[model samples]
Target chain A: MSASAGSEQILHENTLYAEPVFHVGQFPITNSIISSWIVVLLVLVLAWSLRGKIKSVPRGLQNGLEMVFETFFGIFDSITGSRKRTLQFSPFVMAFFFFVLLNNWLGLFPGFGSIGQIVVEDGHKLFIPYLRGATADLNTTLALATIAVVVSHIAGVIAIGWWKYLNRFLNFKVLWEIPQKVIKEPTILLINPIKFFVGIIEIISELAKVASLSFRLFGNIFAGEVLLASMSAILAFGLPLPFMFLEVIVGLIQAIIFAILVLIYLHIATAAEEH
Target chain B: MESLVSIFHIDGKLFLAQLINFAIIFFVLYKFAFKPIAKIMQERTTTIEKSLDDAKAVAKKLAETGLEQTRVLNEAKKDALAIVEKANQAAEVNKQKLIEKTKLEVAAIMAGEKVKIAQEKEESLKEMKQEIAGLVILAVGKVIKEKMTDDKDKKLIAEIISR
Candidate 1:
């Protein structure tokens, strides 16, 4: 983090935002975006290779990929409790895991924070890395979270009827049940209102779900980046190695956590009833 | 809220770009990777199940065939024993009939020989009577010629009876 050989002092800060490494026309490509693009390319090439080499009896990379798929399916089966629904939801969820996991791991490479261009920002020489962790940035996590939630809702609508799915949020069916049941049971009137309010809270919880999903991943990865930066600042060699290993485990855990959470959401959304 | 946005530098274009990135990743993974692989795994599971079923069926048939073979073998042994028993019984009957026939033939020959012997005995007794008559006549003539005495006649009769 120090300047090179008697050059003027530079202030290096691990910014909360992903720094733009370049501009393509009006669109600025951030470091995290570049990292994600690399991840995408890697994933595509991997997919192509696996597609080429895939066999009924898997071998090599195809075998590894099959293991991942089978493990994801098992985790998904535990969550969804039905193979049909697990099959429906696991691919989308696994995509999130692979994306988050790869990005988080790629950030640990040497060039990520160290190799970059220096620019003057607010009159301080700023070191902008060309590639950062995609999940470490808020934008990527937020977008992924939003997609997961939106897709869950869509799955809910597709699984159950849209009318029933709507009642989960608005409690239209419960409100309709109130007038009929209030005469038979007086407690129904009070309980139904509470249930309606609970439905309203459920609406808020959906937003909370997105926030929690995005923030949890973003926080863990971004903190890892900052921790690695701090460790590098202290000693740069032996110190960062431990944290680097920790980040690797953290990266895999966070990815699995994100996927499981998405699967849980998918399960909840696609469930036949409120219970 | 504005300060928070500025701190994170949340950008719509960036969010859109990331979304776009995720979409492409999801598509490629779902289409080219996960879908096909999971399907193949499921197919593998199905194939294994089918093979297991076939093996079970073959084992069951083998057991059934073994049972059938045992049953047939037991029946054949029983039939063979029955045939041997029947042949033994027939031989015993044939042996009894032959013995009875031989016994009848021997009895017939013994009866004819007995009749012949009786006839011979009767003829011999007749011939001996004629000779005795002649001897008595000769003894009477001798007695007359010898000048008759009661004691002599008695002596002659005694001798003739003794002889």
Candidate 2:
């Protein structure tokens, strides 16, 4: 009987339980995907419903939406210092704000991550689930970061010349000094390789931007989810409520940070090079 | 050999899937959400500023009108005072002329009365001298007539005796 009990303990730990959603040939659809799609649909429906309802005198959701836009525009205007710039980039920034805000808030719903079923595939039972917050997934954060960084560079290329942006990577001005250092200090040949390697390192740093932005957001949110999960599992009664509220606040803050970081990156990328 | 699970793991497929999802979202959002709404917000800002400018202009006009009204009121007050002063001056001149005319009429009446009195006194004096001369002549004539009548009676008696 003790052997059976020990085996059951091993079974519980080794199951590798995950919320098995639909699989498209090993690319499993997750609850987080479902939540993101739901957010997309909800945003679409909301925009459609409010379309053409705009008036000289605002009423209902129009007033509320205008107030929010006005507030954010004021903040962005302060940052950008030109109404034209604010207007130009406001759509991208506001989209980030709403999508992230909705995703974060929806994570707080009851049974978001909890409600799932166990499904068996290839002699293994995995926990299949319906809903998870998108930001909690590393994939989602990385993709968002990639889009932000890539789009910012695109904007920079459009703002400044492409050659200037390329120079930031290649740094060809040091080429003239290479011969001087080679003759005076023969050890400079070794240093030149380091400099060449440093250019590659610059490329890696750009890749690191993707990793840092993604991990920062994912770490905070995933940690919050785990904290709530553990709290609920330990107490099962009333102790989890405060932590639940705290997770809600954390989720919102993470979403805001992600969006604002993206905006900052865009601002930096698009700024004119100083002489 | 022992194997430990790594806490940091990258799911490449999941990342690709998310990248596709984000790309679609960004495109859809740019098309549907960004264009019209941003334009509307910009227009709203312009409208608010325009209203504020209109209010400022109206206030400036009101202030100007208030100043002009005060100027007109002061002008009307000056005109009224000028009219009153002119009327007072004319009344003073008329009163002086009336006093002078009254004095001249009194003087003319006094001169006319003095002339009449002098003419009456001269006539009365002439009448008194004529009366006195007439009385003296009457006395002389009475005495001479009585002496002549006696002498003529004596002479007539002598002439009758001579004839």
Candidate topping TM-score: 1
Report the CA-based lDDT of candidate 2 relative to the real structure. Answer: 0.72
User: On residues A1-275, what C-alpha lDDT tens digit does candidate 2 reach at each position?
Assistant: 46554344221111111233777897777778778778888877776766777666767876777787788778787777777887777777777777777877787788677777666556554455567877777667767888888988899889887977765567554454688778788887777666656766877887888888888887777777777777877897998899888987887677667766777777877888542
Runs off by more than 4 Å, candidate 1: A1-6, A173-189, B113-163
TM-score of chain A of 1: 0.95
Give the per-residue lDDT of model 1 (tens digit) for A1-275: 44562386666789899999888988989999998999999999998887756678888887888888888878788878888888888889999999989988998888887788888777667888888888889999999999999999999999998999999989888889998888889998888889999999999999999999999999999999999999999997698898999999999999999999999998889889754
- Candidate with top DockQ is 1
Q: Which candidate is the best by lDDT?
A: 1
Worst 10 residues of 2 chain A by lDDT: A9-18
Q: Is the docking of candidate 2 incorrect, acceptable, medium or high quality?
A: acceptable
